[model samples]
Target: MKINRLLNNNVVVVKEGEEEIIVMGSGIAFGKRKNDIISPDKIEKVFVMKDKVEYEKFTQIIDQLPEEHIALAEEIITYAEKVLKTKLHEHVHVALTDHVSFAIERKKQGFQLKNKLLNEIRVLYSAEYEIGLWALQFINDKLEVQLPEDEAGHIALHLHTAKLNTYTMDETVSTTVLVNELIQKIESKLGVKVEEDSISYQRLMTHLNFALRRVSEGKPFDDVDHDMNELVKEKHKSAYNTAVELGHYLLESYEYVLPPSELVYLTLHIQRIQRNNGEEV
Candidate 1:
């Protein structure tokens, strides 16, 4: 490969065939002047060009970005992959670079746009967002391309969703705990003690499972009752009210919004327990 532009001693922009690639490492581009041949061993990542715009944009950015920024970008990308378990897709990289360039320009113009989203971004993405920011700096400094805000928002949302998976798992665990507690409360209040291993408890578990399933499927509570188990009607009114109350409590306490279908199941369980204990409808 031929050196296209030198970002620093350890990093260089290289042209392979018709595409430009950024090569990085401790001594990858060391002592190599422009137009010099680069050893294959020194090459790290070869960013193949997907189109003319990408090539032009990348080349332009490489020309202006400082060496330290380039190194930082590389470090960020590496850290994000290892820590966040996410790969910054190529489109995201391009978008981020553009944003970084704009941020710097805005700063130079005395317009301070505090990227408070950076904190949420870092927390959600672990460290991948940091790498994205570094890449943005490189793009801004080298290519002078300003990234769009919408693109950055989309990238951040994607990272946030990945982080949300953990929360979802926690929600599942909490749902189980809440269901158990509610059952205990009902048994204690009604004086009709049902064994934990009784058929009724098993059936209640089934209803709870269905509720969780509905939530996952995004079904609405009003629409969730069709084709439901007939046994659900035995305590329909109480179940419905209990489900609604529980749903509201969860939303208020943990910001968890249950889908309609799950609400129906929870309501069914609540009603069944209340009716079995001779509670008035």
Candidate 2:
């Protein structure tokens, strides 16, 4: 396709059918005027817009920032999508690109922001954290700069935001806060810490992440059978009691009551994990 609009020496915007696509490659747009057909051999990546709002913001960045950072963001997002096995939010193109751009600039000027939540992010979002580390390596290779691991945590948070399918920063923070609060209440009720590194604990983390999001959005698991819930309450009395306590806490604190299905699963998870930790359940 012909170059409809050149973003930079290495990037261009092309019209394919009714949609606009951003094309990237080293020197792909160099010395090529508008409407010049891009050589197929020179095309390295083509990013089709999925969210017009996000695409608008991304194109704004493309029109303003240096091409290298835009390219870096593309590489990182592509690699992350492969490892993550899901399509990230389209805003990642602009957000991550802006982050990498400023990160490089700050690194060159001897400035690095310490990520206080680095440890929590490492344990809670290991997948995204690993992807973040990969991003650091990619940046180092392409930009010839060694970014600190704390930057990985920051990048991980960004990836986490996209993974949650939430566009706002507020949603990301809210989810994290709720997850931490739920775990704290569980540990308090059990009078023991859940093993952060254990596989069972990982399972709990995943469950709570989605659970908290649902509660925050006023959504409840509406189809839980009362009979099955009664069975669990009878069979696993101790864990069931703790789950009821947690359910009560949610109602008291968040004004959202947990459904019976959620309580049953919560009891099962708590019992399994507590038993794994050698606690009496």
Candidate 3:
């Protein structure tokens, strides 16, 4: 291998058999200046590019990344690929690699670091970790090697977030809990029997879904009247207000806040259902 461009004393750009590779570690290019004989033992990783354009792109990427970060990223990619038996997409690999690198740096600086995206990461990539660990054990019995546990934990968190984002709670169970509470407060004001399973209730659920989607997309509520139903306009307005209020309440009481649009949609749904069967709202 010959040096092409040196990123740092610890990191170096090199050519190996007509392939460009980013070598990392303490002694990657040790003792030898540029164009000097490189030691294979000191080299940690060799990132082979597909072509000259990719080589240039990879070089630029390495320049932006810190040395320690590059090392951790390489470690993560190698471990994931070798042990997990799963091929992560480039996008996911890059994201995970960068996150791991930054995390390690933060920890070394005495910063109490927590992977905020840990849950999401776990949900998305736990299978990879499971396979990786199994492979590691198979490679060397009593090797005592371990996969990145913290990183694995984060993957699990993402799964939880995904579930909450996609699934709607049953009206008779979780949804009813919130709906019943709201109905009790508005019963005297509207003066009607609230039915839990009415068609209006379903409509309200649909409305809530719309509002939630808008909120999740970061759209403003003022833009909400685009193609709404005329008959449900007043009901939706009322529901939106209540949903916002309930969202705030949940945030304050349980430190859990749904996005504004989500709350708007959910509240509208509950209100519409409660006012079903000729009930007043």
Candidate 4:
């Protein structure tokens, strides 16, 4: 690969064929000028970014980012990919790099942004939330800056945002609100509180969050299985009844209707939470 631009001694924007990609390695760009061919042995990492906007954002931030911070963001993304089992949007690398770099700067200045949805994030995106918490420790060890729990929530939000490909802060907050309201409506109809820390509750929160996003985007769930829906209604009457009530609430308030399959899954989740032991009620 030929060097297109050098960000630093260890990092360079290189041209491979017709595409520009960021390559990182020790001494990869040292004493190298534009059009210099990089040795394969010196290259350690390459961000094969395909998003044009994401590539631009990366170019803008990378020059200002600390080498350690970039490495940390790369590690976090790799770990998140393994946990999430999905390919992340490329912007996550640049976005997370900016977030972490500025977060450290803010910490040194004694300024921290508060995440009001921390509780909801923990309950709803528990897997991502745990990854966020892990990132705090990783950041602390790698950068020696102790970021607060709020930063963890921010990281978790970034992870969630990456999965969706695009999300605004307002949309995240609105989704949280919808999930909370939907859960309350279901609980009220069922005459029992959904255990907030339970596995079932987390699963429901995750499903509802995605469902709310789909609803907001005007995406209707058309793959409803009528046979399974009738089966759930017959086998889990109370849970299905609770789901129906919640469905009505969504229709009345948000004009969002759950597909029959989603309703069946919701009923199963509700029944799981209601069960005292392995046995069904």
Task: Compare the candidates by lDDT and give the number of the best one.
Answer: 2
Clashing pairs in 4: none
**Over the stretch 1-281, how does candidate 3's per-residue lDDT look in tens digits?**
77777866677877777666667667676566778766878876655445566456555656677665555455556665555454433333344445544545555565654544332233333465464344334322422333345545543322222232332223212322443354455444445555434455335433534444444455666423424533344556665555566666655764554754455456556565545644345
Return the TM-score for candidate 1, rounded to 2 decimals: 0.41
User: lDDT scores for all predictions?
Assistant: 0.55, 0.83, 0.50, 0.82
Output the better candidate (1/3) by lDDT: 1
**Which candidate has the top score in TM-score?**
2
TM-score of 2: 0.79
Residue 262, model 1, lDDT: 64
Candidate 4 structure quality by residue, lDDT tens digits, 1-281: 88898988888998768888889887898899999999999987777788888887787787778878887887888899889999777878888889988898899999989887787899877788899999999989987989999888888888887884667656776889788877777777666776777777788888888877776787876465788778879988888888888888788887887777778878887888667334344
lDDT by residue (116-173, candidate 2, tens digit) is 6675677778899999999999899987999999999889888878764454766776
Considering TM-score, where higher is better, how would the candidates rank from best to worst?
2, 4, 1, 3
Model 1: residues >4 Å from true position, as ranges? Answer: 1-20, 26-35, 40-45, 98-111, 115-281
Q: Which parts of model 4 have CA positions greater than 4 angstroms off? A: 164-173, 184-195, 210-249, 259-281
Q: What C-alpha lDDT, on a 0 to 100 scale, does residue 54 get in candidate 3? A: 46
- Candidate 3 stretches greater than 4 Å from native: 16-18, 51-58, 86-94, 104-124, 129-281
Model 1, 1-281: lDDT tens per residue? 77888866776777767666767766776777899988887666655546567656655665676544455445544555566675544443344344444555665576655443433333333344554555455555665655443334333443333342233424434555555555665566445776555556667665654555455566655554456744454547555656666677667775668766666655655556666667765
TM-scores of the models, in the given order? Answer: 0.41, 0.79, 0.39, 0.73
